[model samples]
Target: MNWYLKVLKQYADFKGRARRKEYWMFTLFNIIFSGIAISLDNATGLAQMGVGPIYGLYALALLIPELAVAVRRLHDVGKKGIMLLVVLIPVIGSLWLLFLLVKDSDPNENAYGANPKLIPV
Candidate 1:
């Protein structure tokens, strides 16, 4: 939950590294919210489809932060943030980003900064 708040706080940040917790936590909340919107839309029948639009707008607004986090997360892995775009190749792209997200962070700091995951709370 704290991680979700962290990303929102950082919002447009694209220069620093991001820990896996931060990325995944934000992802989780996004999914949950989208789910609720969809559920609401379904529960109220087509007349309530407006719920989907609301959440769909929410998602569209989040695109920058999502991309920012993706780039930063790749930085944590010591990879170029641009590597994120490689995922555009369908399954390969998704798999690549998934690999970076789950892959271990660099053992030492790279250009982005000290490993965020290693920062003492």
Candidate 2:
């Protein structure tokens, strides 16, 4: 939860490195919340209205932060944040991005900034 909030606090920030915990925690919470919102919409017949519920709006609200975190996470791996565009390539693109996101951060940092995992709390 802290990780999720941390990402939200840094929303729109794409210039720094982000630890895996930061990225994945935010993703996890996003998924959980979206699922809940969708379920609520379906249960309440909002789905019949074609707009579903608030999930679409919530997802829209988070899209920027989600992209920012993903870019930062890629930076933490020593890759350029622009590499996020790889998600447009289909299966291979998504798998490659997932692979990149799961890798441990570069210990000494390359160019983005100091390792978030190594910074003294």
Candidate 3:
């Protein structure tokens, strides 16, 4: 949960490296929260009423942060944050991005900043 909170605290920050644990933990919580919101919305008949699910609202609010974290995660792997644009290429692009995100951060860092996982906390 600290990982998730850390990412949220950073918010729109896109200038640093983010360890895989930080990025993946935040993503796990985001999916969990969104699922809960969607369940509640469905139970309340929001979907039937065309009022939309709370998950949609939550996702909209955090879109920027999500993108920023992803970019930072890419940076952690020594790739330019702009490489995130590859997602726009459909299936292959998204799979490649997933591969990148799951990769270990550069051991010694490569300009974005020190490896968060290697820094003594």
- lDDT (Cα atoms) of all candidates against the true structure: 0.82, 0.88, 0.88
lDDT of 3: 0.88
Model 2: lowest-lDDT 10 consecutive positions: 47-56
**All candidates' TM-scores?**
0.85, 0.92, 0.91
Cα lDDT of model 2 by residue, 4-113, tens digit: 89889998999989988888989999999988888888888887554474777888999999999999999999999889889899899999999999999999958899
Please, what are the lDDT tens digits per residue for candidate 3 over residues 18-108?
A: 9899899999999888878878888888865543558778889889889989999999999998898898998999999999999998999
Clashing pairs in 2: none
Question: After superposing candidate 2, which stretches have Cα over 4 Å from the reference?
Answer: 48-51
TM-score of 3: 0.91
So what's the TM-score on candidate 2? 0.92
| Cα distance off (Å), candidate 2, residue 96 | 0.9
For residues 4-53, could you state the per-residue lDDT of candidate 1 as single tens digits?
A: 77787778999988888888888999788788877766676732535666
Each model's backbone clash number: 1, 0, 0
> Which runs of model 3 end up more than 4 angstroms from their true locations?
48-53
